[model samples]
Target: MTGLLVKNYGIKKAAKLSGVSEYTLRAWERRYSIIIPFRSESNRRLYSEYDINKLKLLRKLTERGIQISNLSSLSINDLKGLLNRVDSEIISTDEKYLQLYDIASVDKTINDSLEAIKNFNEKKLLLILHRAYKKSNFLEFVENVLFPVMVKIGYQWKSGLLRIAHEHFTSAVIVKFVLKISSEFEIKNKAPKIVITSPDGQHHDFGAIIGDSLAASEGWKSTYLGVSLSAEDIATAVNQTNSHCIFLSIIYPNDNPRMEAQLLELSKSIHDDVVIIAGGNAVTGYKDILTNINAHIVKTPKHFRDTLKSIRNQIRIDKRENYEKKYL
Candidate 1:
């Protein structure tokens, strides 16, 4: 009666329950001789509930790079003992697996936004849009798909398929999302600082917030001054913070000339060691304006990553040289 409680599950059902592919399950059973299942009278492999639970644990361990050969020698009791010992240390690994499921479910909400935007359904659209924007790595989701969806929603609103209230609601949701994400990452050290901010008249600060988050994630000491700071204020912030880099975001192309002039003035006011990095749609048509200034121009998030890596490397090299001179 106790054994009967462990109902036999077929391979497909085991795969579904354990979140491992059927091919991988077969490989584990055949190649590694792990989790040998019972055979039915018809000679088909059938896994009991106990065996399925064991397989789930095995899959979790294997994903974390525990050698399969080592696992093959362990009995069910032995595996359970190992899991009991290591489970606390491996919580983050387990969380990653759970996050995969959460990410897939959140992505469905994004897909719903696409459909709602296509149908011009403001109510459904706003709900789904808010859900997707709250997901972890939402900035990537926004840059890749949600941005285009927003453009479509805007076009629909202009053509009268959607109301102005719908557009305002969506923008407010996005602003909150940006704020939430930026606040999640904090400056933890006193490394050479980078101050990122929006230029004068530039109310849009999402790009700057995203850049700050990226910097924080990469362990950069960055001060985000948020939106609507004048060029003089930004230069003063840099001087006061002793920041090595000033990243100015220009979200609209029409503001490039003014932004360029402001940045030029700021660069002149700052010390020669400080670097100015200009980016976003505002620099789209005015690449030439950046030529006279000592600045690095980054156009996208990927470019920003590469540029940040270079800056960090240079900082390291400079520090190493200084250390050699002082200690050696």
Candidate 2:
């Protein structure tokens, strides 16, 4: 490698250093031409120290409600000055700015996605999803963008604003999108494994998709078994993967008589140490059963993340205790 190339970082390293996803970094370089990276002899993207620093500054600015499009041309000193102003409260109050921007931006994208679905414009729908992915951070993209879009699509389909075909189209796109992005995330060494899916008779896979993706973002090695697997299959998969947790997404058929039995069977089948977490619109209908099995019922997106953190902490505690007993 040339000395100049040796001094730069590769795309993955740059992403790690700057707290950005690989796709979004590529988007900024390609779409905005904000920081064109050097191409290695092997055609790899190599970001110089200057480029990584600029990306960090741009991320902070975007977090504080300054748009990314306006940031590309600013000098390093200018970016630092803006950050200083933000720290000194010269910019709008952080929470207020974030709250307003997050709401408006997420709402607009959701609306646009629905519109594209309504028109059966697959291209436009995909464009919206990609743009949203590029603009939002991991949580905002999955929780605020994808989850709400799924909810709205479901609601609109039931209310006859959109047809079943439109729903299928959206789900197909989301499945592909989720599958692609899931591979892009970097997992931690010896990370906990999680199996994300829904019980038999439940075909709504969006919840599991979201859960699986977010688990990867949380540094979990997630295996997303596509929806509608029976309790026995899910249990076997969990054991086979040696997972630390099971995330069940229950989205419809609130009155499925078999669901209670399935949940009971699942609890009995999984390893005793495995954590069970249940979520989705139909989760409440099985609350009694979930509670009986000691499953964590996460009601909202934030609750889902918080529950993951809690379970991970418990896992750490248990590991420490086991190590102390064995070695200390």
Candidate 3:
């Protein structure tokens, strides 16, 4: 069988098409031995169309639960066999998955929440959260119910079904609940000083608040510097708080070159010892920017927790070294 020949695409174009950074693409090639493209006469990598298509297929399959390591060893024929197995598994479990679909199909509950928010019905919103909090694991309920409902509210706000004021009201209520939960957890050690802020022109901050709350709950002393903070303001907060880490919640992509430039500048201005971490929707398509800024992009709640744990260990080591230098 003849392998499909590919036309080489430049790194930038390939990154845009694959929704993966050129750095990440290069890393995958070097680390995983996947998609080895030929070099051009100018010493640029020329990825074939065939290679691009395969990458797209690979991304899709992996997202659907096909382990990349397993797929990496498979020949084209073997991949087809594996895909068939995946399809069969998906079909076999279709009934179990249908519960999610069914929940999504129920528009009335979502609509009611939107209406209640639009009408400023705080009682209804509080009742909803209160009931969910009591009936389910607080964190699970937040992840499953409140998060989905918030997404719906956002959609409605975007579509003009709900107003910005209404959304703010809903958000304020949720923030209170998150803080309530945070209050329950005790700080173990001198909380590692951390500062949380939103990037400039990005005002959605529920995620930041939640992150700060979780960090605090896990024994990190975090200063929540609400929304619309410029890069300079963030630096100021970092200095004022004597923070070791700065976490920014970005909720949308800033296609503006100025914003990108600010992020780069911000990265350079911060102390080398400080870890800059970014999370939320705004940072989704801009992971490369984070890399450029010497920052880490965290994609999920689990990642956030793990990062805090790692930072805590580093702090412990630093404290021990400082004590030894002073006494021994």
Candidate 4:
């Protein structure tokens, strides 16, 4: 489908619209020919509306782990087609790969957990996860087995291969583990206190627990205020905790028409000093709204950690500068 016809946009506007840096855009054009921009007489680069949409789609697909090098030559329709297919590398239902793959021993851990879920044995599932945690580092378990297992479980549920009870059981066990681990390793004096929770209508809360765990691991005092909270309640919790950042976790079927309104209200109610972020499966649907309201969207635990660290570093810099100005 053709995007809207608009005036030719310069490189800066194109990068902002496409969510690609100007340097990256130039690099992609030179190396991959992803979206070649038109050049003016003075050598300024210009992009059309169609080019902008294509670049945005490329960014989204690349974020999902598709290599831009492989996708650069394809049309937008081809990219969409590939995305529509089940990502075989990720949430594939292929029995051969699911039951037999032995890379890093992570596949076995994931398959074992899935089997325990199938048998409706919560204890067994938790045992497998605990064993995996014992065998691998926290980040390894999170990135390799835990996160992939959740994605596979969701895919199975939506495909009618599993029931809601299975998802609930797994979520309950995982959240318990996340909280226990976070508590075990928390630094009492950690700065940039972070508050995580699901806003009203979002029944899933595992994402919040995961955020709390990661934030704690990064030496942040992370507090999880359970799920299904109204805007006023969330704001109250943040205010009470004197949180430096608030993370809103959203789950699938995020058909909450009131979500944007709720976010806007919460943003307005909270102190401007606090940073707001949204994450989880349903975050894509609210990206535009989040950006409009000055809220950040993080897609992975690593991304979340990096964002917090950047903020913490900036705070440190500001404090050092203030101290120097006062005394040195």
- Candidate with best TM-score: 4
lDDT of 3: 0.69
Please write out the lDDT profile of model 2 over residues 7-53, one tens digit for every residue.
47888778655645565687688888987888889999988777777
The best candidate in terms of lDDT: 2
Q: What lDDT tens digits, residue by residue, belong to model 1 across residues 7-70?
A: 5788877765554545567767888888777778888778787877677667656544477778
Any runs in candidate 4 off by more than 4 Å, and if so which? 1-106, 325-328
**Residue-wise C-alpha lDDT for candidate 3, range 206-320, written one tens digit per residue:** 9898788868766888888898788888987898777889888887654645678778767666665677778775675676677555465665555567677766676677677
TM-score, candidate 4, is: 0.67
Clashing pairs in 3: 6-48, 6-49, 7-48, 7-49, 8-46, 8-47, 251-282, 252-282
Judge candidate 2 against the unseen true structure and give its global Cα lDDT, from 0 to 1.
0.78
Clashes of each: 0, 0, 8, 0
RMSD of 1: 21.9
Better of 1 and 4 by TM-score: 4
TM-score of 1: 0.56
The candidate with the higher TM-score, 2 or 3, is: 2
lDDT (CA) per prediction: 0.66, 0.78, 0.69, 0.76
Clashes of 1: 0
Candidate 1 stretches greater than 4 Å from native: 1-111, 114-139, 157-160, 253-257
Task: List clashing residue pairs in candidate 2.
Answer: none
Single out the weakest 10-residue window by summed lDDT for candidate 2. Answer: 90-99
* TM-score for predicted model 3 compared with the true structure: 0.62
